[model samples]
Target: MKFLFLICAAQGRPTATPVDNGTVVGTLGPVDDDVEVWVKEYDEGSAEDSGRRLAGDRLTGHTETVRVRGGEVLVTDGPFLESKEYIAGFDLIEAPSLDVAREIASKHPMAHYTGIEIRPLPE
Candidate 1:
């Protein structure tokens, strides 16, 4: 099974801090052979630019909302939520099961400071 982990933080880039990637890689090495992981961060750009960039890629960074109502298009910047939390990055990981995926997500270095939401992909 494959799981997508949405990494959320308080409205900033995931790599904004000087995190030691080596440490994280070492921590996850045990599961590395069993799972395939792809990590991506949101691009540093204006909301409109980010949205446009995301349209051509598999990952989305900062977001914009467009709603059509009564022939009018309403546009809004930032995430859909009213809270400060925003999705900063994501990890697409292939694991043996949901339990294993959750375990792997929990081991992510960002999990200590931010939130990781795990969702299973269709087999």
Candidate 2:
């Protein structure tokens, strides 16, 4: 099984730079001594609705605890980041092709709202 990470970068603010390739799990940065990062396990056919339901649920569960510095708290529905390049959310795609991965990503809940960058884990 491979793991994929969907990271959000700071919008011209003091924040960690998004790493392109590395271990699936690691601390990207810290806030109040707490490391900020996300992790997900991926296998074939993992980006479909069934997979998304589980993954989305997991991410949503942690929404309250995840903090962004200088991040706006939305009173109404809004995009995840204030920056154009910042990631709003991610899906763990098990497909072998980039087109397939991107297609899966394009249908994600966050895709309609913010940008989603789909990159494979470095072997």
Candidate 3:
């Protein structure tokens, strides 16, 4: 099975290593180095990298909406939805089972600091 890892954080760019919150913190996972290793492991045999960062770094706190209604097109400038979190990027991987996939996701460096949502492809 193949899964998509949606990396999320409560603040800015997906690349930022989050600061420790005031709450008690536990052991931290390896950061940038592990990310480099993870990327190399996934990209070694592929034609292109298995993952890529998103453009949330350029959000500028504004968004544009597009829609077609009543046979006409409409455009608006504003946030479509309210969200305290943003998807920083995605990683696509193949695993034998959901458990294996979850394990892979948990290894992502940001998984310790942020959230990773695992989703299987329907098709």
Candidate 4:
């Protein structure tokens, strides 16, 4: 089975202080062979700046959102939701079962200060 671990943190909270990579890496046990991890830095400045960064260009901040209602298109800016949390990164992992996936997620270094959501992928 495969699962995705969504790493999240509070919206306004600055990124956690850096920890020794070796210390973080040591927690995975043998499951390291079955997982691929990606880390993302928290977005700073304006939303337009984030959009520009996402586009690999130089600009201000703002993320565009488009919606269709009554055959009319609506465009908006900023995040998709107004919440206290944002996703910081993710891990895609293969495990023998959900139990194994949960165990793997619980061992992630970020699990100590951030939220980790484990979700199964469909076949």
Candidate 5:
């Protein structure tokens, strides 16, 4: 029914920028190598291969983690977890099935360099 695509990339990677050829590069090579990466979510109402984009965008730099310990709220800079990678962006997609959702995620350029986590949402 619905899925959340967590677009992750290596820490400190640069944002997606359009090259001179007017192609968007998302943390890796050109997103328009042979098939362009669909940066947005697929349309829910249409079953067409090329559907309307629902909602998606690249996240800005910097992140914060908030936690409550000892009855006090604590806030810290950067992600809550320490690792070599971080969530670079996200795409909220509507797919007919998990298999199709995986297909959509594979099209992302970030999937080539890092990884994309697909989580299905409850109906």
Candidate 6:
């Protein structure tokens, strides 16, 4: 089994313009719904380590922003959307099977409707 973890560092490019147009002007495709384990932020040390690892484990230094495919819509200074549904990032961990994923997701830090979706990876 394989998994894809999507970490939303920052919102992607904004689709809407400043002209107060009623409609957004960018593309927002469907995200991988079968995501497991969501969190506001990871451990500080792990965060730093992940950043370092992203730069090929180079400790020299690198930028501090991560982008996602459909991240731009929900972030803004003002309330652009009606619902408060927002996503930070997701973890797609693959255990031996779905039951294992369920067990892992059940112990998530933020439990409840924040149920992690466990599914087979697309070919």
- Per-candidate TM-scores read 0.55, 0.35, 0.61, 0.53, 0.68, 0.33
Top TM-score prediction, candidate number? 5
Q: Candidate 6: misplaced stretches above 4 Å?
A: 4-83
lDDT of 4 by residue, 87-108 (tens): 6556566666787666655655
lDDT of 2: 0.39
**Considering lDDT, where higher is better, how would the candidates rank from best to worst?**
5, 3, 1, 4, 2, 6
Task: Evaluate residue 42 in candidate 4 and report its C-alpha lDDT on the 0 to 100 scale.
Answer: 15
**lDDT assessment of candidate 4:** 0.50
Q: Model 6, 1-123: lDDT tens per residue?
A: 534332222244333333324333122321212121133222111332231111111021122434455656333244243433333435555445555545545544322223234455664
Ranking by TM-score: 5, 3, 1, 4, 2, 6
What's the true lDDT of residue 111 in model 1? 66
- State the displacement of the C-alpha of residue 67, model 5, in Å, after optimal TM-score superposition: 1.9
Number of the top lDDT candidate: 5
- Measured with C-alpha atoms, the lDDT of residue 121 in candidate 6 is 67
Model 1 bad stretches (over 4 Å): 11-61
| lDDT minimum window of 10 residues, candidate 2 | 32-41
Off by over 4 Å in 4: 12-64, 80-82
lDDT of each: 0.52, 0.39, 0.59, 0.50, 0.65, 0.34
lDDT of 6 at 95: 49
Q: Report lDDT (Cα) of residue 32, candidate 2.
A: 17
Candidate 1, poorest ten consecutive residues by summed lDDT: 48-57
Residue-by-residue lDDT tens digits, candidate 5, 43-109: 4433554333457677887788788999999998867667778787787877777877787777666
Alpha carbon lDDT at 101, candidate 3: 71
Give the alpha carbon lDDT tens digit for every residue of 1-123 in model 3.
Answer: 667777665554334443533222122334546666766665553333333322112124555778999989999986554786766567777666677777767766667667788888664
In angstroms, how far off is 18's CA in candidate 5? 21
Per-residue error (Å), model 3, residue 97: 1.0
Per-residue C-alpha lDDT of model 2 across residues 1-29, encoded as one tens digit per residue: 22243634334434332441221222232
